[model samples]
Target: MSELIQTYWPMIVAALVLGVAVAWFVFSTSRKTRVTGTSRDVLDEGAAPAERNKALIDSAPAATPMQPAGGAAATPDATGDDLTRIKGLGPKLAATLRDMGVTGFAQIAAWDDAEIDRIDARLGRFQGRIRRDDWVGQAKLLAQGEDAGFAQRYGKLS
Candidate 1:
């Protein structure tokens, strides 16, 4: 065992150095951005308003729902279809939409130009995709359960 260790000592040292380098790279890159709050502070559901507000402002921005003229927040329907069924919406985009309180094809189908603009602004990198993809038109068909029509127009909903 001593002879084998001596034989491969240089290689073993190289491997240890390589492993340390890779570990350092991974850990350095994987460090989460240093926000103003701790994970516990952010995760506390019943935190006081001051802490909650601090956490909210320090966290990454997410989609914010556009309220109607009545000032009541629009919520997604409980029986809404899986939004990922829409051609352009992958799981990530669907989750983002859900986070924004968008559920149900009918809600999307009913969006006017102004509402679409407002919501598009909140979509970050996905802005203008709604109009580009004709989501409203596709949504109208989907809401009506017109799979055949939707498929004909937008291809398969994969």
Candidate 2:
């Protein structure tokens, strides 16, 4: 047993670290509430980015989680624009953006240079992808319904 402990100590230590990380992630996520604007439905559709951001900032405190009277969650939480439509963005990146309160093409399209830099700093391994992939350009095309141009530039969207 003593010999085994010496040989496997590194693995045991790694497992313990992983366990702590998972627990911290779970606890942190559970404690974070989704901040929303006065009209999530309207804000997500056809609205310009600056207007949307302004509204969200002004109305964030008034918004609450959408729990139906019937004790079920709202459908909006599960719905958003298909972010994967942008070529370089994968599932993990999309989830990270969602966690950061991004949901629609319009939202991403609206990011200014400052916002891009700010967001890029938080992307960890995905840093610079927003600029490298031209997320704003791709999102602009999609948000404006330029399918042919988007397909030509970034491949076909499903």
Candidate 3:
């Protein structure tokens, strides 16, 4: 029995060590793969760099012509108005209007139906909002720089 134990002791130790190493390797590799796989799943699958860049570019406002160059009226400087003072206009629409070169109450108040349609068409998701919210009337009142009527009618200043 002692001889048998001595003969097989080293082999037993080596077998135990090999088994532990294989188990450790399998578990570690599976754990790493699971972590990476879950992280990949959490990331946006459709969000390619080119598509994301294109969406950003598309969302960016284009440079709009404010007034005719060298025409009858002198072009207004690029300084913009706070179009948000109009009751219905939030900051986003105000920024969009400013991007479209609509910087003053005079410009908005002066819009005829055709001009309104043209501008409204440019308003993207805000189409028909001008007519619905009476933006022209609001502009007319705001252009005068007196808010008495506007406040009475619109309930509050923006």
Candidate 4:
């Protein structure tokens, strides 16, 4: 084994490097931006007049039922709130969710663990985000109009 390793060390190193490259590509392309500690915590929930972290709409087309953007599609049908308001969810992911028929907080809040797993599977690269960011917990408060509660835990969404 030692003699073989010495003879083929370059090959082994190259294989390891290739594997690392693939992993990096897979992870960087699929995963959403990481959440910061400050961004995750709601600093102010009581300040109704103050609107922080307002929804940033992309330069996408507005259509009924769904507004598709050029790349990062923004906005959903009349019933849907800005899905990007949730932490770890960016414009691209929001568009993907919209394509999957996930429109609003109500829809997300209603997802059971089983449903989350099912949905997560279809997320392609954005898998496991639902549980990781605790979207359901945030959605539950948002769905119920509990801004204070949401702000208290998951931060404010304008």
Candidate 5:
């Protein structure tokens, strides 16, 4: 029994040491790689590299005017005012309104609070801001073709 114990003791010790070494290595590696930045860090430091890269890509001049895959001109209505010119209307919301046959501010101006709420729901977190921003008043001014009142009313569009 003593002989057996002596033989296994060294093995047991080695195994324990190996486990501790492995655990330490894993823990240290994870700590080193973990993101340490807080939300304030991001806000204070400006946009991250990935976001800057994306903005650069989006703003890069096109090599050639993009044509439709099937060779169509891809011309949207040239006359109607772009609803996306409004303060809170993003590309997605503009596309949504366009899909709903809402090409201009007139369509939006016609929408009641309930309808606006429904539209705002599609925009996720922007709903409250959009509602409070007096989108209807801005839309009404745009629909009426009055420019002078807009700046005083909506501040800036973009």
Candidate 6:
């Protein structure tokens, strides 16, 4: 029994030492790097309103006035109604539509069920809203310079 213990004791000690060494090496290597304020300072405090505004302006696409809620009015550029003009479209869905060749309302209105289904498959969560909202018909009316049925249905147009 003593001989057996002696024989394995060195192996056990060596394994313990190796485990400690590996643990220390892993911990030491995982130390976080200190980030200098260079990147953060550029974006953080002391930024002037004009500079911030300019940065925002530069980062953002050129502003188009948002259409009224429920797409009550036609937008200035009649060529293509902005899909994002719909109230429900978030940035992600709008981008998805753009990816699916649905850049305009006319395109959406012109799309058959198969094409819309394809778009819906890509859009996932936005599918139900797109179908329920009648986005295509609204888009078509907007494209045709109609007052979105307010004049006809309500007897007065905005």
- Best model number under lDDT: 2
lDDT string for model 6 (1-158, tens) is: 99998989999899999999999999998896776665444445785456857888779576453222233232334444455655456678877665544566656666566655666676676667767766666666656667756245423432
Question: Which candidate order results from sorting by lDDT in descending order?
Answer: 2, 1, 3, 4, 5, 6
Give per-residue lDDT, candidate 1, residue 123.
84
Ranking by TM-score: 1, 3, 2, 4, 5, 6
TM per candidate comes to 0.54, 0.50, 0.54, 0.49, 0.47, 0.42
Cα shift from native, residue 34, model 5 (Å)? 27
Instruction: Please give the range of 10 consecutive residues that has the lowest summed lDDT in model 1.
Output: 66-75
- Tell me the whole-model lDDT of each prediction, alpha carbons only: 0.78, 0.80, 0.77, 0.75, 0.68, 0.62
Residue pairs clashing, model 2? none
Stretches of candidate 3 off by over 4 Å are 1-62, 66-78
Give the clash count for model 4: 0
Tell how far residue 54 is off in model 1, in angstroms: 8.3
Cand. 6 Cα-lDDT: 0.62
Residue 74, candidate 4: Cα error in Å is 21
RMSD of each: 13.0, 22.6, 11.6, 22.2, 13.9, 10.6
* Lowest summed lDDT window (length 10), candidate 6: 66-75
Clashes of each: 0, 0, 0, 0, 0, 0
Cα lDDT, model 1, residue 57: 87
* Model 1 residue 13 distance off true place after TM-score fit, in angstroms: 44
Worst 10 residues of 5 by lDDT: 65-74
lDDT, residue 11, candidate 5: 93
lDDT string, candidate 5, 51-141, tens digits: 8767888896744422222222123355656777787777887776665445667666676766667666756666675677677778888
- lDDT by residue (tens digit), candidate 2, 1-158: 99999999999999999999999999999999997757655457785667757787877475333222232211233477889889899999988887776777877877778778877887999999999999999989988889999999888886
